[model samples]
Target: MDNHDLVALSERRQHQVDGVLTAFFRESHYRAKALGTPYATLWETLERNATGGKRFRPRMVMAAYEALGGEEPERAAYVGAAFELLHTALIVHDDVIDRDFMRRGGLNVSGSYRDIATTAGIPLPVAEHRGMSVAIIAGDLALFNAYRLIDRSGVEGALRTRLHDILDEAMFVSAAGELLDVDFALRQRPPSVDEVVEMERLKTAGYSFEGPLRAGAVLALASAEAEEALAGFGRNIGIAYQIVDDLLGVFGDERDTGKTTVGDLREGKSTVLFAHAVGTPEWAEVSDWFGSPELSVEQAQRIREVLEAAGSRRFAEALARDFANRAWESLTSEALPDAVREEFRPVVASVLGRVR
Candidate 1:
């Protein structure tokens, strides 16, 4: 299909997934209401946090399923919705870990609850703890609903089993990756660039790209060869995506990305950029400000300047481009149908040029 047709197709698939999500949230809200007002409010907060984004995971699923000639668009959408829920689950938990209160330029689950508590005259420490507790339950609910969506999807027998397995692998590997990330940040010794890259792959790549693509292929009943090729493509592209995310976290416009550019710096995230900058004269100059919870905007800008001067920014950009190129190469595999290649061509382009 041409670019215009591809865009239209993606829109249609996204619409289908959105409809499924709306129904899922509606049903979940009612179920929670049966429990109590507080339970219902939690579901409402989750719904607010979950909806509205690029909906990229669902799009990835539909892309592979349709490209490989899967017959059931509706069923595929259910599977796609499952992945989106998983994404929400991970991010909600991640925000608690990062001590973040904002997402997409608005109050997140924890932030929302924390504000409500403070508004009611609760103590700061108690309010913060209450917010974190609510967010943890919210994340758990999202995670559970992710699996429930897949099980309720009309797919049966081995297909369903395989789908569950793929989701299981995503959750398992992602947990390991999150642990690695926390470990890296806490350790006195800095992580190597290669180790940072590996951490990115495990944290974001598995679920965000590979699992979605592979799930689509399985839904389509594509050959093992085709599945493996698509998995490689997803992995490379996912790594590249996360690297760009790191860059964006440090330098991109907050208005465009709907996130703070300095959160990573404040948290002392062990990214590839940090790995390259560690031990440099420039880093030593501003190292004291790197992980300060009270980090200022001026301090962040100074750090950004130092990173740019030290070529850490250029290094990360180059690494991202390298991975994007590898993702393109993965498309050349004969196992992938020509239509599949065409579908992903724009995905690579978007990853390389994305501003948010």
Candidate 2:
């Protein structure tokens, strides 16, 4: 398939997924009204947060299913919707953990509640707590709905069972990764490159890419070998994707990336880039600035310069490219149909050019 065909296919898949999401939210809003005022409000907040993302996870499911010869677009839509809901839940929870008020340059789920409470004249501490509480419950509801969507997807009972098992494992692994991430941040010292990469693989890779792709393969009744190949591809590419994210956090323009650029440095995230920079000569000049609440854009730029001079930026970019290449090789290991392979080729181009 050519670029135009790929773009057209993506648009169609996006429309179908949106249709499923709209129907789900409409029904959820109706059901929530009977519960209470808070329930209704929370449901509305979820609907809003769910509306904005690129819906990348859902597209992953569709691509994998189609590549594996799954013919029913409606069936793929159901699976895509389930994965998208799962993505929504995780991001909501992640925002709470990160204490981030904005996503894609707009108020996030917790941020919305926080803003509402603060606007009502609640004290800062109390308002923040209340917002966090609402967000926690909102995330929980999203997760529950994700599983519900899959359960009602009308696939064979046996297939659904396998999919659930895959999802359950992914969630469990992701929770552990989240725990490790929190610990890594709280530690006195930065993590090693291997430690950071392991955390990323468990956290973002499993749920964001690996799980969705594998779930689609299961829906298509793909062989074990195909699933294995896709799993490897997903994990490696997901890591590369996260590395790109880390790069963007420090260097990308907020206008283009649609999020603040200094968050990672302020959070003192132990990315592979950080690991690469630690112990270098440049570390002494800026080690104290990371994790500082008072971090300035100027200081951020200085640190970016240090990271660049220390070769960390090149290190990370090279690592991402290497993984992208490996992911392509892994994808080709399976006898994926040619058309499917062609569809996936764009993923390499997209990932490689993400920060360019």
Candidate 3:
């Protein structure tokens, strides 16, 4: 699809998701009045953050739903919106946990709240504390809101129970993945490939791909065979997304992938690309590139050059394509409907081929 096709696809999917979300907020009353000051600001902040994202996870869910013979576009779209909200909430919390100041080209929850406090003449330290406190609570509230969106969804019965179970378990895995992120960050030694890939699955895949899409599919009472197949497709695609994300972190244009630009290098992110470079003989300066307070921009550029020269970029790119091909294979393997399956190839290609 060209840029026009991409725009149309995005518009159609977003409209469907938003209609459901609007109804959810209206039914739940959003409780905006109950939250005070900075806490209330979080809702506005999350709303601001939610609307502009790529919508890939929800699209993944919708695709899986369509693939499996489910035909209600509105229902599929709303489910996708729920997944988007869940992801937005996760990013809000993650930024605070990482103490990041900027996200998606703006001051994030913590930073915005800090600015609010400072503008009110609060001391810098006190303002910073208030910001962190408010942001944490805001993330918690977003998480609560996520569950409410799913639970109060118009759909009901034992299928809801199954969906709830899958969501709960996926949430645990996401947390476990986050824990590994922190632990690995603290490690002085390089992580093994096995550990790195597992982190990609937990921190990056299951919820981002498997959980949300499956939650939607199960609501349609997707068969056991269909569920397994979709799960495999999501898993491979999710891992591939993470690989591309890691590559972009180090190599993408600063203006395109606004979040985590150079964050990987400064924080020594343990991605597959980095593993390949460090393990290879070509990037002999890999350890020196790990980063230090004194490392200059020039030094960073040279290190990136070393990684590329070692074929880390090529390795990661090939792996991402391989995984995407596998995803297409799973998607078309008699588990999904004809219309959904027809678009699956295009969607996967478009997403995997993104530069940033």
Candidate 4:
């Protein structure tokens, strides 16, 4: 186990993804090849967008599998790559909707096309609209490819139906949660912490933890009891993870997190800390900033101070620890297999240690 090469393992798996993407693009129609700049170019864009990142979701799957005493690392890598594809598909669609021009210091799909059109002297609005349409199609295609990859994984049988159900449910719940999140942003009053937490659980945990890791363990023939236990653990940890993500979105250094501080402020995101700040009378001024297009970074900084004064940051951090502790409890339980427990624990540490 000590000799296992994690970097080499990652590259070999990435190569597998590259080969699959290459074959898919090569079979494309002539017009698509022309527009996508040799189909390989489009795949390369997705690959580029996916670069220099933590592979947390996939690693969670592997950890759960290893905890179940499974040893098929290559097969687990395929499971992970499929998830990365799914995640990138979500990112493509999300960036288009947000009109976000850059991600990871590179032009996002819509942004690149918009730039190209504008450089060619087209009107900015026309360029952006066309670029958005193209991005939407690209995102849809990526999602379709994700499903295809999962189907071709040869992970079949009674558990196959269960996996299918899990995926379907995750999609439905996440979409509903996302819709609610959009609605919350538009509301005069932000959502309560409980409501936001529920949304985070459905939108984040289902896909990020419950479904993928369970699929990995299922692939390894893990018992139903073990799978259920993992799901419980994952759900708690995922909520904590998303809450931390909210904190990072609002407070992390852009150079470190690959995003600007208080990005949630610009969007007026209805996160837990946002709720706490607004609810406190001492920080009640925060309500005035919600949905205020006139709000500036200077004002947001001051409001974040109010949040700090209200102990929201500390509150959120404590909550994060609570959820993480719960996951640790489950991971160490007798319900989990004996041989795989120690390896799985590191995954929790990895999740908790992420800077971004």
Candidate 3 on 69-117: residue-level lDDT in tens?
6777666675666677777777877787777767777887788888989
lDDT of each: 0.90, 0.85, 0.74, 0.71
Which model is ahead, 2 or 4, in terms of lDDT?
A: 2
The order of the candidates by lDDT, greatest first, is 1, 2, 3, 4
lDDT of 2: 0.85
Candidate 3 displacement at residue 8 in angstroms: 3.4
Which ranges in model 4 have alpha carbons more than 4 Å from their true place? 1-43, 50-52, 290-295, 350-356
TM-score of each: 0.96, 0.96, 0.88, 0.86
Per-candidate count of clashing residue pairs (backbone under 3 Å): 0, 0, 2, 0
Which pairs clash in the backbone of model 1?
A: none
| Model 2 error, position 306 (Å) | 0.3
Please give, for residues 1-356, the per-residue lDDT of candidate 1 as tens digits: 67688778888998999999999999989998999999999999999999957888988888999889898888889999999999999999999998888888788899999999999999988898889889999999999989888876788999999999999998899999999988987888999999999999998899999999999999999999999999999999999999999999998888887788888899888899999998577789888899888999999999999998888998999899899989999988999889898889987897778632
The Cα error of candidate 4 at residue 203, in Å, is: 1.6
Candidates 1 and 2 compared: the better one by lDDT is: 1
lDDT of 4 by residue, 230-329 (tens): 8878888788788888888877778877887755787677788887777777676766775465778888888778878898877877777778778878
Judged by lDDT, which candidate is best? Answer: 1
Candidate 2 Cα outliers beyond 4 Å, as residue runs? 354-356
- Which of candidates 2 and 3 reaches a greater lDDT? 2
